[model samples]
Target: MPKAIYAIWWDPNLGPFLGRSYPENDPLTSEEAVVIFMGHGLQQEAKVGYTKLAKGLVVSYLDSPNCIAVLLDENDDPSVVERNLLRLVGRINFNSSKWDAEITRAFLLLQELIAETSGQELLSNPHVTRLVEDMATGRVSALVPRHVLRATAKYPKASDYLGPDEEEVSRLLKDLERAGHLVPKTYGRRVECRQCGGTEVTLELACPSCGSNDIYKVYLVFCPKCGNRTQTVLVDDLTEVRCQQCKQPAKVSELSVIDVELLCKGCGQATNDPKIVLSCANCGKHMTNTDLLGGTGLAYYPA
Candidate 1:
């Protein structure tokens, strides 16, 4: 099995930038990056190949036109490493502008591969052992939702009990559930993009009247002394509204401020409710909430 995997971005003028690494603490250092660049002759030679270094045998692939990914292992078969690297890279979108997110996903995929390759080692991890022990002892009865929104899909609460990385914890919990150590209960559904099937969907509030996302809450200030209604403004720590008709400033205490409605900037219409639109980050697809695909939201209990 590979000891570490790296995603590196090669720049023509600057050199290599270490994008991400699996087992994050063990990152590919500057010296190693220089060696890889010089040894492979990346500037002048082949874009992808395998090479043996003092650290290990590295199987590299050109993930994108400028990005390279490599798997490092001292004793693993180079052919096997190359094959695994190809399989793992195939699942990632290197062309995406969101480099951080894509690189993180790539590393997570690498972690899964490492876990599968060394299942016993992973199960023996101190954190994993403690989590299992806690569940077995009834200390943690079930892994429930941390928040009402983005519930099972993000597993925000799992980090509190399992580990700092919610995604990693979620993956571990799913592994245990798949292994029959935990029982799963479906309580809700998540919306996913129908085109790309990506779960990273964001909800946008659009004006129902004009179907525009440029909506702002309307706040009106009413001054009884001047019998004027105008927009409120923040002056230092106080709310002040200057009437256009009387040119009199009214303090917050002397005025009745109300949140009238959500006003659309496009059509100048106000409404209490706005249309919810689901947008896919991966494919840039926009659709109504009802048009999205439903995914299961789950809570887990020790079996």
Candidate 2:
């Protein structure tokens, strides 16, 4: 029920950096900041979240949460909440954290910043990560409009604020978020959406008949007559569809797709759903959709 939760797994050094920070955008290094992480539990996506440890150097950090804001719904359904939460975690191709001495205190500051901001801004901005060493942790707040000018500073690798494996840091953060230990700001418009970018329903193919996309996209049953429900595509009158299982063929004419209109994925509208229009022989009362279905008789029943 806690609105926010946070956890941290410090490198033998920089772990402390995740909490109350020291200065502007400063952060520790991979060597000193490396640490393994454990986990905590939370329901899931009915919340808001972001990681101080981001991608690039920390490309793999997204497997879990560093901090999250969850709502305590009456039913307490956390079933999908976990998977929804992981969408923010990126799918990394390579790694980026290994840098040299040229790295500055800038990265340290970045980590401190994002630990306290929203997810959208952190992923959008450009300059917020200029001198930063690791994406695993830094100024996600730079993208946050309010935190832009302040320049969240970075710390040295010398501080226990560092983490060894970015994954450990990921686990620690998720653990805290799950346990309701961290305090996150109120969730914004982005959190409420059922889809973002190309990430639509978790299921790829949905059932054409009932629209049920859970478990699998298909099912098989016994054919009543032939019991020969094979994968063969049978060509009938170009209308009737037969169940390969029951071997029972049904006429396309018999099935009714009534009361439903199709939204063309191409046109993005409901115009093509065969419309039913009426013009009163006497009063000219033309109707469509529901109006057509409810008529007692065809307007022209000649006596």
Candidate 3:
């Protein structure tokens, strides 16, 4: 078990010395460890791993511009400590508002998960380690939230690359939630493309006949002077409304509103209701809104 966890931010000029440390009087110095790790001059070094420290092993990971180091006991498994650190960082980053309180809970969960009642390290199971690693830093964009109970991991970038052990990851996250190690938060539902399961779908109302997104709100007005029933176009500071026919001009308020509808810029079709189209940004597939898969989406943070 690790005694303390430190979330340190590394700066090129300021050396590596910002962020909060847990259990302040620990024997290890996480900031100095981060400085030493960065100074190693290996751009290709593995971002997450464990290394020997002065008193004990330090599990350190580079979280982009910041670093998190955990000081572990001599008898502790280094890989387990590293995995736990990643998981903690995942939680901290996911729910930044409650991070101060979550730091203690994460370390406690890590200690519990590291050793079972029989004193066996769970890190021996490759499935467990992989699941934890994926939960922390999977190939997901920051804006996208990976569903905790999803069957397979989605790869929006690579069309053909299937994720490895995705079911296991999903199962592991659910189990963690049940064990009070994960807090799930829902941010409403999203419709995804049925073919590629891409969530980057745009819900647009377009011309059904032409399939054009260039639809504009149009107001048809009746010009009393010329008796012209034509499309009313607002011009010159929006105070002047002109009829398409007869070039009759009147104040916007003076014209009687006959109909308000969406006019398509492509085929010039005017209708009260526009066609709901779902466009997949990833694959450029156009389909009806019904073709999308709707599900309750969620995100999770360590409890």
Candidate 4:
């Protein structure tokens, strides 16, 4: 089986370093790891594995994959990761509060399934069926709890992804929870913030394509049914970019910046990244930081 190890980091801004602990050193130590998971911060669900080449890719991801890490991997494959993450988000994101269990489960399934050789065909497997059942039964977990009991006793070992006694399955769950991907709900206790004791959080939501939050203002050029506008965002991963307001469908390289607003999955609001985009955990839509300033409070401007 492919060995897997998980880790989590919590902070207001997760966009900085994915795996590395912010304001600290690289390769975080387990001792400094928090004892609990928070409902805020960035959540990363990573599962790294190699099939040993002889195993021939046995089984389609395992029933629930147990309490696997919510966020995983920090390879330089930002392009692929970003595209997949946004694609998944585009399908489910409604531009409102943080993702719920249903949303988390959907993405969890998506991440696990996307890598498979035959995804749609593999859905019929018993393991996939059980995962769906777990999600429906409300026993699903996108992130492991902070005080997690080792799943080794039950599963007897890490799934095909992670390796040995590296990081307990529980720790992976905590990382996901911290990454703002999974919702942590346990019995007889409440999940609170690890930082300021404030459970409330604000995540920037923007156009997954344009990475912008000016939804209401820009003239949405795409049909809104497909990922046309979205393809524009990834036009050039190598450098700064301009929108490709092509009168017709064209290559991302052929596109040029014009007037339009993009949408973000972090927040459900339409926004362009070049401008100000804010994520609102309250409602999973994209908005300007100024959007929050509208209601009798500290007024600020869009940067």
- Say which candidate scores most in TM-score: 1
Relative to the true structure, how large is the alpha-carbon lDDT of every model?
A: 0.64, 0.28, 0.58, 0.33
In model 1, what are the clashing residue pairs, if there are any? none
**TM-scores of the models, in the order given:** 0.54, 0.19, 0.37, 0.17
Clashing pairs in 3: none
lDDT of 2 by residue, 133-248 (tens): 23224422211111111111112221123244333333333333343432233221110111211111121333333433232212132344464433322234466567665657
Query: Model 3, which residues run further than 4 Å from truth?
Result: 27-31, 39-41, 94-100, 116-303
- Global lDDT of model 4: 0.33
Clash counts per candidate, in order, are 0, 62, 0, 59
- The candidate that wins on lDDT is 1
lDDT of 4 at 114: 38
Better of 2 and 4 by TM-score: 2
Error of 1 at 238 (Å): 12
Please provide, for model 3 over 67-147, each residue's C-alpha lDDT reduced to its tens digit, 9 standing for 90 to 100: 667778777756556545555565555336665565566667667655531122443455444444454565332212443
Q: Which residue segments of model 2 deviate by more than 4 Å?
A: 1-42, 46-107, 111-203, 208-303
Score candidate 2 by lDDT. Answer: 0.28
Q: Each candidate: RMSD to true structure? A: 10.8, 22.9, 14.4, 23.7
lDDT of 1 by residue, 1-303 (tens): 567667776677787787767657677877777666654443324334665666676767663334455656556655444544555766887777886677667756765664563436546667666766787898877777553333325554456556675655766776666556678898566665565445565678889977999877665767766776776544456666677668877666677776556778899988877887767654567855553536666888777
